[model samples]
Target: MRFLVDECTGPAVARWLEEKGHDVFSVYDDAPGIADSKIIRRSHEEGRILITNDKDFGGKVYRERSPHCGIVLLRLGNERGQNKISVLRRLLEEYAGRLPDQFVVAAAEQVRFASKEE
Candidate 1:
């Protein structure tokens, strides 16, 4: 899988993804301080699933109708890097094949897939 890790999502998660053999582009490492709109646009253009902690992206995709290859929105109760990685690990283990072109919200206990129109 290819991923665009948002700046706020941090380098640890990006590193973990890389270790898992996913092609990863880290905004924190490659392009710091970039705007959220550009991040989403770049992710779409590159055909990368965006990994972000920002709720604003829901508005961008749902309300503004922005196009995306895929998005994994982390709504974890524990925002620590390890917790994020654990949540992502579970999500990938269970739903990797179903991820593309979906808006997925991952929490500590559950994962939800939002309808594209929603």
Candidate 2:
């Protein structure tokens, strides 16, 4: 899988994704301080699933109707990198094949999929 890890999502999660053999573009490491709109556009253009903790992206995709390859929105209460990784690990383990073109919200205990048309 290919991923664009949002800067707020941190480098640790990006590194862990790399260790899991995914092609990763870490905004924190690669392009710091880029705008959220550009990040989403770039991720869509590059066919990369975006891993982000930013809730503003929800408005971008749902309300503004921005294009995206896929988006994994981590809505964890913990907000720590390890917790993010654990949620993502479970998400990929169970839903990898179903990810593309979807808006997915992963919490500590559950995963929710939102329709693109919604």
Return the lDDT, model 1, position 65: 98
Tens digits of per-residue lDDT for model 2, 1-113: 99999999999999999999999999999999999999999999999999999999999998999999999999989988898999999999999999999999999998999
Candidate 2 regions with alpha-carbon error over 4 angstroms: none
Q: After superposition, how far is residue 42 of candidate 1 from its true place, in Å?
A: 0.3
Question: lDDT of all the models against the reference?
Answer: 0.95, 0.95
- Model 2 residue 117 lDDT? 81
Candidate 2 lDDT (Cα, whole model)? 0.95
Worst 10 residues of 1 by lDDT: 109-118
Summarize candidate 1's per-residue lDDT along 10-114 as a digit string, tens digits. Answer: 999999999999999999999999999999999999999999999999999998999999999999778999999999999999999999999999989989998
How many residue pairs clash in each candidate at the backbone level? 0, 0
Q: Which stretches of candidate 1 lie over 4 Å from their true place?
A: none
Estimate candidate 1's alpha-carbon lDDT, on a 0 to 1 scale: 0.95
